[model samples]
Target: MTTPLTSTQQAILAYALEHTDGRIEWFPASLKGGARKKVLYSLCRHALIQPSGDNWQITPAGYEAMGRPCPAQKSVPAKPHTRQNSKQAQVIAMLSMPEGTTIPQICIATGWQAHSVRGMLSGVFKKKLGLTIVSVKTDAGDRSYRIA
Candidate 1:
């Protein structure tokens, strides 16, 4: 037996499931602050939603609760190398290196300030493209980043 979801949780889950094929991106603007947090926390606790990078994606259990068929699973291919000449593309290329890339290296390559580089990493890559970025500190005390 399973517990029933509250009306708020149902609404949040429904809204999230409605976006795209299975992933949820646009959280309703109407859900603000504590109310939103409570709903999201409840869903996560019930395994109805899981974090995918910076976004929330529905789980198989979530589909079951919603009475919808889960989307068929597909193997995700490796992220392809970005060959464009744009600065953001170049930054991504640098991060894709086996040794990963440092903030200083990315800044030097893209002629961007450190803040701009950080913004791109968090905003464009994580939020927009849903890329998982891993950051590590080396013995040399320099931080490196790569797509994980």
Candidate 2:
């Protein structure tokens, strides 16, 4: 069996359970710096928690240790998620058009700078969302983007 959990570990795990997202960003105000690191180490050492991005995530072992029922796993949607009224949706809709869209047009539509539009195209659409974006430049010097 793993070492018995400390009260601090229990509290953190309980908080993560209660929140249902399993993200562990909260801590008692008194638990600072080295003390916090020690608690995290203990939780990890016992296989109760795991590092996810910048925060810790309570593991299935954590729920078992806490005597709490585990939350149902969330499923990723088959389609890309986008808020209907968001600027991202607007940009996507514009790109979906057969005529496609230009940087200046997207800038005006989304109220984002040209560079910001380019960054979103590269970072959010291409890299993060794994979208294949087609960029074409016309003889008239107009460059357009579309999702392929």
Candidate 3:
């Protein structure tokens, strides 16, 4: 189920739909700094908008939430599965190892920053793929993860 948007979020999405044609580039005067970041973040976390190079573009779900029609675009069939040798696959391989893997190790392997790697683990691996990932903290204080 789609979570109801706060007033700030509603304003942001509605503006994107009506004015910017689904590009989120405006905010209220009071929405600034960390508060602005938080609004953008909640919108993204809810799958209402997504990164589009330099901009945040509203998604189909965002339109639905706003009770608006999605603009027509060229239809491109989406890939059904990740390619075997893609970075995502590589990370999955690392996680599948019996010994598990560490975030730092995954970051080193994929050239992704720690937060990006962590986001991938939760958003892609767990939520989307429905994988049960288990984490353990070694006595030495390092955290490791594995597919359980």
Candidate 4:
């Protein structure tokens, strides 16, 4: 016997079943922040889904619960192109350099504030693009970042 699913869990499972081959790439707009985490945790705890890379994949029990056949695995899609003249592109280019790039340099080049640059490094570069960022501290008390 399978555990019952809440409406939110059902919806998440349905979306994953219908839209994706198996990967839960598109999370519903209504599920956000901690609420989203809680739902995902519940699903995983119930053996309904498991993490796959940054996304989730439904388990066999999940299919039984959903009364749907498991879909075949799909090829991972390519990343979308970033605008060449965009600040993100500039930052990526700067980080790709041999010397790497400092926050101040990125700020100077993009006219962004210090915090904004840091946010871009964390949010856009690391989280969104899934880029591995390495930070090194210099003798001058400056931090340099490179995509590793």
The best candidate in terms of TM-score = 2
| Residue pairs in candidate 2 whose N, alpha carbon or C atoms collide under 3 angstroms | none
How many clashes in each candidate?
Answer: 0, 0, 0, 0
Residue 16, candidate 3: Cα error in Å is 0.8
TM-score of 2: 0.58
Return the clash pairs for model 1, or none.
none
Worst 10 residues of 4 by lDDT: 19-28
Q: Report how far residue 17 has shifted in candidate 4, in Å.
A: 13
The TM-scores of all predictions, comma-separated, are 0.47, 0.58, 0.49, 0.49
lDDT score for candidate 2 against the true structure? 0.87
lDDT tens digits by residue: candidate 2, 31-147 = 999999999998898888999988899888887888877778888768856789999889989989887999999988888998999999999999988888999996779998999
lDDT of each: 0.83, 0.87, 0.92, 0.87
Which residue ranges in model 2 land beyond 4 Å of their true spot?
80-148
Expressed as tens digits, the lDDT of each residue in 1-148 for candidate 1 is 4549887767666777675665665556787889877777887898988889887788999989888889888989988676688887888788888889999999888888999999999999999889999999988999999988
List runs of model 4 lying over 4 Å from the truth: 1-78
What is residue 86's positional error in candidate 3, in angstroms? Answer: 44
The residue pairs that clash in candidate 3, if any, are: none
RMSD of 4: 10.4
RMSD in Å for model 3: 13.2
Best by lDDT: 3
Candidate 2 vs candidate 4, TM-score winner: 2
